[model samples]
Target: MELTERQKRIIQIVKENEPISADNIAKHLYLSKPTLRTDLTILTMTGILDARPKVGYFFAGQNFEPLLFEDLYEKSISEIMVPPVVIKKEATINDAVTMLFMHDVGTLYVTENQVLLGIISRKDLLRSTISNTSINKVPVAMIMTRMPNVVTLQEDERILDAGYKIIQHQIDSLPVISKDNPALVIGKVSKTVVLKHFIDEAMHLKK
Candidate 1:
C-alpha cells in the first residue's frame, strides 16, 4: 500500500523516538489522536510497525556491532532462523489448536505440497470456534486467512533493514525466503527475537 507523505513523515518520527506513546506521537506531529491511531493501525496491519497494547510503538532495533551493512547483507536467511511450524489446509481446527499450543505460536503458515497457501492465526481459530458448533469438525482452511500476501527478505539483507521493514509494515514477523526460491520458506524473523537482540545491544552499549 502506498503511504501518503504525512504517513511517511510519521514513520520517520516514530522511528527516531520509538516505544513512544500515541498521544506523544500525535503531539509531536501536530495531529489528532484519532488520525494518528488510524495511520498507526494501517501501518501495523501492513507489517511496517509494531504496536504493543500499552508499550506503544517502536522501531525494531538491531545489535550495535559496528560492522558495515555489506558485512551482514551477504548472509542468507537460513543462517539465522528457526524451523517454521506449519499446518496443512486439510487440517482440522482441533489440529490447529493443538499445533498452536505445542509450538507456542500465535500463527501458523498453512502449506500444501511444500507451498504456502494461507495462514491460521490464534484469532482466526478463536473466532471460528466461538461462532461455530464443532471446533474439531471444521477444516482450518475454512477460516484461515488465505494467501496472506507475504513479505520476504533476502538472506543477505542487513538485519537492521529487516527491522525497518518490520516497523514499516507493522508486522510481528517476516518470512525469510531464498532469493532463488522465493516460494520456499527458509526462516522467520519474529518481533520478539528482533526486540531481544536490540534491547540486549542497547543495554550493552550503555556499559
Candidate 2:
C-alpha cells in the first residue's frame, strides 16, 4: 500500500477539515473534482479516508503508514537490534553454555569490562564438550572467534546492509558495535530477528 503524493496530500486535507466534500478537497489541491475521483476512491477503499453520501470525506485513521520498499528495509540497525547476551572472556565453557540457554540465543558476545573481546557460539561449546575438555575450568577465550576476525555491524547501518552481511558471512548473528569505538558492543542483530521484522511488517501491511 504505497500512497502517491496526491493521495497523501488528500489525507492531510481531509484531516484538517473533516466531512469535507470532494469539491473542497479539489479546491485545496487546485484541481478539478473529476481529476481527484480515482485518488479519493482508492483512499477510501484502503480505509485511509471515509466517504459519505452527504458528508464528503473524513480521515479514517487506519493504515496511516505508507508501506514502501525503502521504508521497510532501509531502517537502521538500532531500530531493530536486540540487547547482546554478553559473557566475560574468562568465563568457563560451562558458564558460556548456561548463558546461551538462559538467553535462548544462538551466539554470545564475549567482553572484558564493557569492551567486546570475541564471540562464542553453540558449535564452539559442543566441540569443546566432544573433545573431552574440562568445561568448568576451560576459559571461553580459548575457543571464541576473536575480534578483528569477527564480522560486526555498525549501529547506524541499514537493515538491508545487515541482511546482506549476515548472508555473505554465513553467520547466524552479528554483534552491533558503536560507531565511535568498534570494540564496544551495543546490541545484536540475528538472522531470526531480521526475518521476524520482515514477517511482522508484511503482516502489518496486510492489515
Candidate 3:
C-alpha cells in the first residue's frame, strides 16, 4: 500500500520521539485526536508502527540484539515478576473475585500442588455472574480455562521471542513458566514489556 504524506509524517514523529502519546502527536501537529487516530491506525496496519494500550505507538521493523540487553532484562523470573495472585482448584468463585480485586490483575492462575492447573480471567467471572450463577458456591475450577490450552513462555526465552508470541497468539500476556517445572509459572510478559523494549531499542539506534 502506498503511504500517504501525512502517514509518512506521523511515522517520522513516532520514529523521532517514540513511546510518544497519540494525543501529544495531535497537539504538536495541530491535528484533532480523531485525525491522528486515523493516521496511527493506518501506520500500524502497514507494519511501520505498533500500538500498545496505555503506552502509545512505536516504530517497528528494526533488527535487535537479545544478548545486548540480556543483563538488563534477563533477570530470573522471580526477580522481575509481580507475585501471581493464584486460586486453588477448590477455591470458591468468590475467592477468585477477591483475589482479582486484591491484586488488581485481570487474570488469576489456578494451581494444584504448585502446578499450573488453569486460569480464571475477569471475563470468566463476568460470564458466571451474567448467568446468575452463585459465585460463593461455585468452584473456580468450574469456570477456569484448563491447562494444556493455556499459552505460556519461559523466562529463559529472549524478550524478543516473548513479544513475538504475544503478537502471534493475540493474547494480552503470557505466563512465564519455570524451566525446571513447566507446570510452575514465574511471571508474565505483557504488551507493556514488549513495547518498552521496542521503544528502548529504537531510541538506542537513533542515538
Candidate 4:
C-alpha cells in the first residue's frame, strides 16, 4: 500500500528521533496530536512503525515492504483483467466508432476468425473520418495498429510488468493475449483498472 505525504513525514521524524512522544512528533510538523491519530494508527497497524506503552514510535525496519511487493505488485494480470471490447476485421470505421462509445472503451481490438489482427483507437477513427467522407464504406483494417506493432500482455504476466509497459509506452490500455495461442485475444487492462485495483486493495487492508 502507498502512504500519504503526511505519513511519510511522520516516519522520517520518528526515524530521526526514535522513541519520541506523539506530542513531540506533532510539534515537529506544526500539527496537533489529535490530527495525527489516524496516521499514527495506520503506520503502526501496517508494521511500519512500532509503539510501546510509555515510549513512542520507531521505524519497523521495512517489515511491510515484502507485503507491498509480493502481495500487490507480483499479482497476475488475469486476476484483475476484464473482457476486451472487440470488433471484426470487416467492420467499418463507423461500426468501430459506435462500438467504442457503446462500450465506453479507449481502444477496440480487431479480429478475424477469433484471431487477433489489430487495434483501433479514437485517434485512428478520427483521422480516418477527417480524410474520408465515406466512413461507412471504409474498413477499420485500413487504418489500424496491426499485430507485431500493437503492444499486448499475457495472462500469466505480473501486474508490475503491465504497469511498466503502460508507463513506458504511454498507452492507456493493452489487450491480453492467450498464452496457448498468441493470435487469440482474451482480456483487457487499462489505467483505470490498475488504479482501481490498487485503491480497492489499499482500502480493504486499511479496514
Candidate 5:
C-alpha cells in the first residue's frame, strides 16, 4: 500500500483536525472530494485513519508501513530465487525422474560441475517415455531442453520478469544464472516463489 503524497498529506490533515469532514479536507488540500475517496478508504482500511459516517474522520492511533505493497514485482530475482536442483547431463531419464520427484520441484537443471547444460521437467521426461525410444535407456542429455533455447534469468533481473517469462514460455521454473557467465546456474525461482510473495503480502496484515 504505497501511499501517494496526497494520501500522506491527507493523513497529516486528519491528524491535525480530528473529526474533520471529507469535503472540508478536500477543500483544504484543493482536491476534488471524489478524488479522495480511494485514498481515504485505503488509509482507513490499513488502520492509518478512522471514520464514522456522520462524525467524519479521525486519526486511528495507528501508522501503516507506506511501502508495504510498493514495487514488489520489481524486486530482484536473486532475492526470491531458491536453491537450484541439478542432475548430471549424462544421467538416464529414469535418474532425472528420480531427482525430480526427490526434490519435489517442477524442473531440474542438467549440469556438470555447476555449469548449466540444459533443463528437464516432468513433461520432458514424460514425453520421452511416450516416444518409441525406451525412456529408461535414454540419457537426460537427449531428453533435456538444452541451453540457447532454455529461458533463464540473471541474478539482478526483476522477479516480475521471472513471472512474465514463466507465463510467456509456459514453464514451471526458471534458472537464475550469473551475469558474467550465463552457463553458471546460481539459483532458481518458481511459481511458488512468486506466489509466496502474494501470500506473505496478504498474511502481513495488522499494521
Candidate 6:
C-alpha cells in the first residue's frame, strides 16, 4: 500500500517536530481530529510510523528512497512511459526547436511512420541554433544524433533499465521501442517520470 499526500505530509510534520499531538497535525492541515486519527491508525499499523504514551508520531524506519527504488525496480516502463515526441527526419532544426517547446520534452525522436531514425535533444538544438546562421533551413537529419548511436529501451524492460540508462548515458530521456521491432518507436521515459511514478506508489491512498 502507498501513503497519500496528506499522510506523507503528516509524516514530515512528525519528523520535523516530533512528539506532536494528533490534534496539532489535524489543525495544521485544517482537517478534523477523527479523520487524522484514522490516518494515524493506518500508518502505525503499516509500520511506517510509531506512537507512544503521551507522545505523538515519529518516523519508524530509515532510507525511504531505497525502498521506493526497489519498488520501482519491479515496475515496467510501459506503465509510465509517455508517447514519444517525434519530429520528421526532414524537418528543420528550427522546426525541432518549435516542437520541443510545444511538447515540452527534453528529447525528440526523428522518425517516419513510427520507425525510429534519429534523436535530437534540447542541447543539440541549442548548440546548433547558437552557432549556425540558417538553422531553419538546416534539416534535423543534419543535427540529430542518428540511430546506432541512440540509447533506446524495449517494452520488455523495467523502469530500472530506463533509470540506469538515464544515469549511464547521462541523457535526459530514453526512446522506448517495440520489442518485436526495435526500430519502431513506441514511447519515451525520463528520470522525472520514473521517480514521480515511484513516489506516487510510495505515498498512495490511505485505505
Q: Could you give candidate 6's per-residue lDDT for residues 72-171 as a string of tens digits?
A: 5656878889888889988998899999999888999999999999899999999999999998799999988988899999987987677667766789
Scanning candidate 2 in windows of ten residues, the lowest lDDT window is 64-73
- For residue 165, what is the lDDT in candidate 6? 75
lDDT of 4 at 85: 90
Clashes of 2: 0
Error of 6 at 152 (Å): 0.7
Q: Would you give me the overall lDDT of model 2? A: 0.85
Candidate 2: residue 8 Cα off by (Å): 28
Per-candidate TM vs. native?
0.61, 0.67, 0.59, 0.70, 0.65, 0.67
Q: What does candidate 4's lDDT look like per residue over 35-96, in tens digits?
A: 78767865775578999979988898855565765556679999999998999988999999
What order do candidates take by lDDT, descending? 4, 2, 5, 6, 3, 1
Clashes of 6: 3
Instruction: Name model 5 segments beyond 4 Å from true.
Output: 1-66, 69-71
Ranked by TM-score, the better of candidates 1 and 5 is 5
Error in Å for residue 178 of model 4 = 1.0
Number of the top TM-score candidate:
4
How many residue pairs clash (N, CA or C atoms closer than 3 angstroms) in each of the candidate models, in the order given?
14, 0, 0, 0, 1, 3
Question: Could you tell me which residue pairs clash in candidate 2?
Answer: none
Clashing pairs in 4: none
- Comparing 3 with 5 on TM-score, the higher-scoring candidate is 5
lDDT of model 6 at position 76: 82
Cα lDDT, all candidates: 0.69, 0.85, 0.72, 0.86, 0.82, 0.81
RMSD of each: 7.8, 13.8, 8.9, 9.9, 10.1, 11.5
lDDT pick, better of 3 and 6: 6
Which window of ten consecutive residues has the lowest lDDT sum in model 4? Answer: 62-71
